[model samples]
Target: MRGVLVFDVDGVLVDVTDSYRETIIRTIEHFTSRRVTRDDIQQIKNLGGYNDDWALCKKVIQDFGCHPKYQEIVDHFQRIFLGENSDGLILRERWVARDGLFEQLAKDWRLAIFTGRTRSETRLTLDRFGAQAVFDPLIGNDDVENLKPAPDGLLKICATFPGVEVVYVGDTVDDAKSAGRAGVGFIGVAPQQDSRRAELVELFRQEGARAVVDNINELEQVLK
Candidate 1:
């Protein structure tokens, strides 16, 4: 009676590309007077890095403590990192919620989000993108101690809407793992050139992913 469609926000929904890393690099530079290269940021993302962005900044602090106003620098970086997004970040023609993505899915499933982003950031992205209206319930990183690759978010979604066919659609291997951990159907949305996606696809299948789509548009056929 309550089927669900859960999504990952960053690449699947937001199309962040390199902005997250770029902003974070800038943030680290602003704080500790050290600027991490794009390659380093990609490494961090690949390594499943977490533990308060400040910790990442701390790593740089050891090298360049030259910044006079470290606290101010940190504050500036925070503002930029978790800072307000531009209109394009929220709603651009190219990234308009996958062009009838939720619309088709919502017809059959109770749509929702299970992203690594904070609820505040999630709301900002969704509302600005005009996507909030499509989903009845939303699950954000703020709701759980752990994120993707952790079952908390998926399990929470399953618990919220019990006795329903659950489908977790996400762009990362972590998404597939989280869905498997939650004992639900995992649909891997493996966007092309998404960095290790082929290996991730194999991992997804090994982890019990039901399907893997190249894009949200492909989800229609894959879900069927």
Candidate 2:
């Protein structure tokens, strides 16, 4: 059987250091009315099971001794991340994969996405990168009750493409756990930035990832 490749959007494919991560820090600060540093956000991310930024923001707010309704937090987050006007959000992100990487992978393996991003957000990013047609069975947060570390998204992708070896490419410990629970191979992509890369690589290695790479472009070599 041909191999199936499942992807995590945020850290593996798109660099979220500026966009989603910034939004999480800003949202916490916005709700608490106090500054939350990127390090604070990284602390939460490092603990794993925080693929959903909305949920992460809520946790940060609650941890800071504040109580706000979930919908209110979501509204504020969407406003700031998606932006209030045509100018768009203050934060920006870029693709971690090399140009035409997905298309090239699609030629040899079935490509799919299992990400914590919402369907709309995933669509917007895919459209932006001209990758809408590359992946199949894109599983977003809305599609699964339990997210990463629960294996819900990975299992769903496996169910969709059965009788094939599935390899999940992601950047976090949760992603490795999900792939492990779902009985799929995991390739960890360490954070692109230098400061976090070594630590993240060690973390993924500790998780028993099939392989770990510093760049998404290196994924091709790992799979081979």
Best by TM-score: 2
lDDT of each: 0.68, 0.82
Cα-based TM-score, every candidate? 0.76, 0.91
Best by lDDT: 2
RMSD of each: 4.0, 1.9
Candidate 1: where is the Cα deviation over 4 Å?
Answer: 28-44, 49-77, 82-96
Each candidate's clash count = 0, 0
Model 2 agreement with the true structure over 180-211: per-residue lDDT tens digits = 88888989887555466676777778777989
Weakest lDDT window of 10 consecutive positions for candidate 1: 87-96
User: Local error of candidate 2 at 134, Å?
Assistant: 0.6
Error of 2 at 109 (Å): 0.8
